[model samples]
Target: METKAISLGRSLSVPFVQELAKKGLISVPPRYVHTDQDPPIISLDSSSPQVPVIDMQRLLYEDFMDSELQKLDQACREWGFFQLINHEISSKLVGKVKLETEEFFTMPMEEKSKYVQQGDLEGYGNMFVLS
Candidate 1:
């Protein structure tokens, strides 16, 4: 019997692997396996540093001083992305929206076929567009 070798990427979780094994798609042993031996390299001597951490709470609660604005501008210019520590958006609503979006995307093609866009008219199914 020919055994097929499978390559598991770095981001895949172990539980996913076990689930695949249970489904009999891939025959993975019941032990942790490290397929790749090469480790990621890190440069210690480089002067350029990692992304800067932004404190959103400070920006929200404290007075918006010139120094703070400068720091914010500098962060936007340098990193282009920063973490929001204290966001006001509700986590529950976000999760619900995410779930709904996933469910909508996973709907059957036949079901999705019901929604047809018409020219000029903003309506579902067969419709004519008004110029």
Candidate 2:
């Protein structure tokens, strides 16, 4: 039996930043740099903006569940991502994953292109853009 391939949307092929950096250019390509857009939120105070952190331990408790869930929602809405703390995953396993990901990225462009996002959501290229 054959498995069906899945695709979220089509994405335009773009050069990798690693390839661009290899050129040793002093300035980034204008297309790669955005000069016009300002951040959506600006703080008057000097404190720097921070990514929200969602504590898994707190989420597990009845007393903290509601508040923690709200934090998770706010994190997704405002920051798009958040740090997950007290997850208790094996550090060794996390390290291995990190190493493997680094190794994959270090692979030559030709080798990496084998997993190219060919009109699919699951591959190596950009994920959100649709053509």
Best by lDDT: 2
Clashing pairs in 2: none
- Alpha-carbon error at 67 in model 1, in Å? 3.7
| TM-score top scorer | 2
Instruction: State in Å the error of residue 63, model 2.
Output: 2.0
**What stretches of model 2 exceed 4 Å from their correct place?**
1-8, 35-46
lDDT of candidate 1 at residue 71, scale 0 to 100: 74
- Residues 1-131, model 2: lDDT tens digits: 99997756555666788998999978877666656755556667658677699999999999999999999999998788999989999999899999999999999999999998766666887876433
Residue range 1-131, candidate 1, lDDT tens digits: 99865533223223433245557865556344445544333668566465566666667655754555677788898667765555577999889999987886566545655663423234333232111
Q: After superposition, how far is residue 60 of candidate 2 from its true place, in Å?
A: 2.2
lDDT of 1 at 124: 34
**lDDT score for residue 11 of model 2:** 59
Score every model by TM-score: 0.32, 0.75
> Looking at model 2, how many pairs of residues clash?
0
Q: Give the alpha-carbon lDDT of every model.
A: 0.55, 0.84
Model 1 clash pairs? 119-129, 120-129, 121-129
